[model samples]
Target: DGPLARLRDRNQLDRADKARNFALAQAGEKYRECFFRAGLDPLRTLDPSQEVKSAFSPNGLWRCESQIENLQKFRAAREAIPEDFREPLAAIVLEDREIVDVGREIGAYKDAKMAGAVALFILRRGLTALARHYRLISPTGAV
Candidate 1:
């Protein structure tokens, strides 16, 4: 059997012995557990054929894919909003503006909660419009 298969067997044995104590609920914890279960080998590659010293590791590939997905989501979000509203929302996200500050900038709402609600409503509407534009959703709002 391969090293990975052996490791998997060992992990399963350990888990059986531990009665699920090794299991984690959170995603980050689960990833860490996977690494630990793999015996914490720095030189190990998911693809055994790849060199241990390869610049593009499995983690790097996963990160690259995650970044692309995030960029796509950002683009979709930007395209959803009006041109004028873009700058303000960008400032809120990038500059870490406070709820009160956002409220002040967005006018007509005295309450911070109300302002936040309004912003959320706008964001939802924009996303829905974008969904319609992409034809992922129908006019009756069936996705």
Candidate 2:
């Protein structure tokens, strides 16, 4: 599960907080899909048993066409958002980093509480923008 799933499972985010808010969850899924399909995810070296075999060899001569297309889409999506919001969005959505760590990296919070709050706010806004870019929801707030 990604950060959004973890948040939802922990009851931090409810499906019905507002009708529009549900789009955030859908957006998160799309963001993760793009990241995965682009082949940007890090190799899992921590646990050899958990590793899945890839069709492409380590020499990188074989390239998947879908992965190339997804990489273009991912780059376009990333370019659609504000520069400042990108890091936090990537950290949480793509890298699965904690909000607190993102907050610390952002570097202006007086306390961890404030840092987490700000990071969460940035993540939500970033995902909302992504949702519109993906057309998972309309620009006028219709899901």
Candidate 3:
């Protein structure tokens, strides 16, 4: 990898440049700032453009359900968790987990800014953890 390597790096960076553009009407500056303050970089990659929002979101409350359930299995009784704490995990979650496979996943999508940025950010950062968490509840790519 010589100067040619720099060219390769450029090719890779180009996609992320495109990905940032994909974040949409809603995933605006506030979401970006929130994520950034929380430690996830908004411009990590291109958007996935999945265009799918679930009633049970992946961020906070969804996590709470599984976390609470796991606790029950670990102990005879599971303590009731606060709904507030369970919310989307949001930027707070980023501080706990860093990017895992940034080069491939985060560097690869094309979608809404907030969702895509968060997806790439989460995939790059919390993917392994998310995968591990997913494994406990469902299959690997369920989320």
The 10-residue segment of model 3 with minimum total lDDT is 74-83
Best by lDDT: 2
lDDT for each residue of candidate 3 in 1-143, tens digit (9 for 90 to 100): 32212322444212443332222101222232333433223343311122213432454332344434433332211011122322222322323322222223333533344444444333222322332332321334222
Off by over 4 Å in 1: 1-80, 88-101
TM-score of each: 0.34, 0.76, 0.17
Indicate whether candidate 2 or candidate 3 has the larger TM-score. 2
Candidate 2 at 131: error in angstroms?
Answer: 0.5
Report lDDT (CA) for all predictions: 0.41, 0.72, 0.29
Model 1, position 28: C-alpha lDDT score: 16
Residue pairs in candidate 2 whose N, alpha carbon or C atoms collide under 3 angstroms? none
- Which model is ahead, 1 or 3, in terms of lDDT? 1
lDDT: worst 10-residue window of model 2: 44-53
Per-residue C-alpha lDDT of model 2 across residues 4-74, encoded as one tens digit per residue: 77765654533455545666777777777977876666553221123324544465432578866776787
Sort the candidates on TM-score, descending order: 2, 1, 3
The regions of model 3 sitting more than 4 angstroms off are 1-69, 73-111, 130-143
lDDT preference between candidates 1 and 2, better one: 2
